[model samples]
Target: MAAPAPTAIRLHRQRRVLELTWADGRRHEFSCEYLRVFSPSAELRGHGLPEPMLVGGKRDVGIARIEPVGRYAVRLVFDDGHDSGLYSWDVFDELARDEARNWTRYLERLAEVDMSRDRDVVKLAALVGQYKPPQKPGG
Candidate 1:
């Protein structure tokens, strides 16, 4: 598979989804959950010998915030408050290739671990809320 070019990439956040536009003008809608599960950070990738993680409870994952990590990457802050992973050009390229297969394997891994992404997502949100103060009504 040909690797994607960073020069041809653009990312737009919309509520719970991100719309990515390639230089070639092709666009794709990717959710925060999809991006999170596929994060390239060591927390999920584990260095060069990256040990893949089982990301469950992401059926409803949404992007709560976004931080540009540089011209080469973007940190995706999930609604669940997970903002550790930094996605790079290389990693995003890999994600674009046969993403269906990758996602399928993730689901399988979740099952193997007896976990549910959707349910775990709910738990994560709850935990983060415990430490962070409640948001203002219109803030």
Candidate 2:
């Protein structure tokens, strides 16, 4: 019982989002930064390490190209010159399902390390969109 494949895929250049409409009529939109950070490439996956490397400074990353692979995956070429990951249908489904939780965890990890998502600057209080950092015990 394989997961159902996406019926349509659209890249919104202006928004920098990759949108996939699955066969079940569910649509998932992924930001370019999100996709890059979550890429399944061994490079990002850390070559079998217990945890993946924390990718920072991808707030403005964009997908340069998308190439189909056989019948199960697509290779995403990022503007930053990354094109190693082969994203499969299964991976896409899993990502879509866990997007919220995954994003929160990523942000938390960044906060833990005082990392920045900006390309060349590190801001201790730079937050994006509607992400409200967890409050400290006493501010």
Candidate 3:
């Protein structure tokens, strides 16, 4: 069965959070940075790689607008001009369910590559000795 849509969608711009409340009395507050990084857009999700690309440097993003698409999804327009993702109810549910794990994983991935949540800030270690070139296929 498909996931149920949020009964109430509230954007707390001041706090930079997207809150969703469902019929089952479940509520989740997602950070704008979280939603932006985990966006269901092809630019992020459609990367043809086995895993989705890691997105960093969006710690302060806010939702500019939310446009409903039919009964199943909403398109999130970010203040940073990213408006490609269609966030379906299922997507929201999955995000809420896995928020903790996902956030941890995201942070770990960023650290692995010496990436930063702050824009344009690369770790000095990455610039010095931690930089490793991508491996060739099957090498």
The Cα local distance difference test for each model comes to 0.69, 0.86, 0.90
| Tens digits of lDDT, candidate 2, 76-100 | 9999999999999998988888889
Stretches off by above 4 angstroms in model 3 are: 120-139
What TM-score would you give candidate 2 relative to the actual structure? Answer: 0.82
Cα lDDT of model 1 by residue, 1-139, tens digit? 5435444433454555676666776666666678888877678777665446666777777787767776777788887778888777566766776588888887786765557876654355555666867799999
Q: Which is the better candidate, 2 or 3, if ranked by TM-score?
A: 3
Ranking by lDDT: 3, 2, 1
RMSD of each: 11.5, 9.3, 4.4
Summing lDDT over every window of 10 consecutive residues in candidate 3, give the lowest-scoring window: 119-128
Q: Which runs in model 1 stand beyond 4 Å of their true positions? A: 1-15, 48-51, 121-139
The backbone clash count of each candidate, in order, is 6, 0, 0
Q: Model 2: how far is 84 from its true place, Å?
A: 0.6
Candidate 1 overall lDDT versus native: 0.69
Clashing pairs in 1: 8-23, 56-117, 57-116, 57-117, 57-118, 58-117
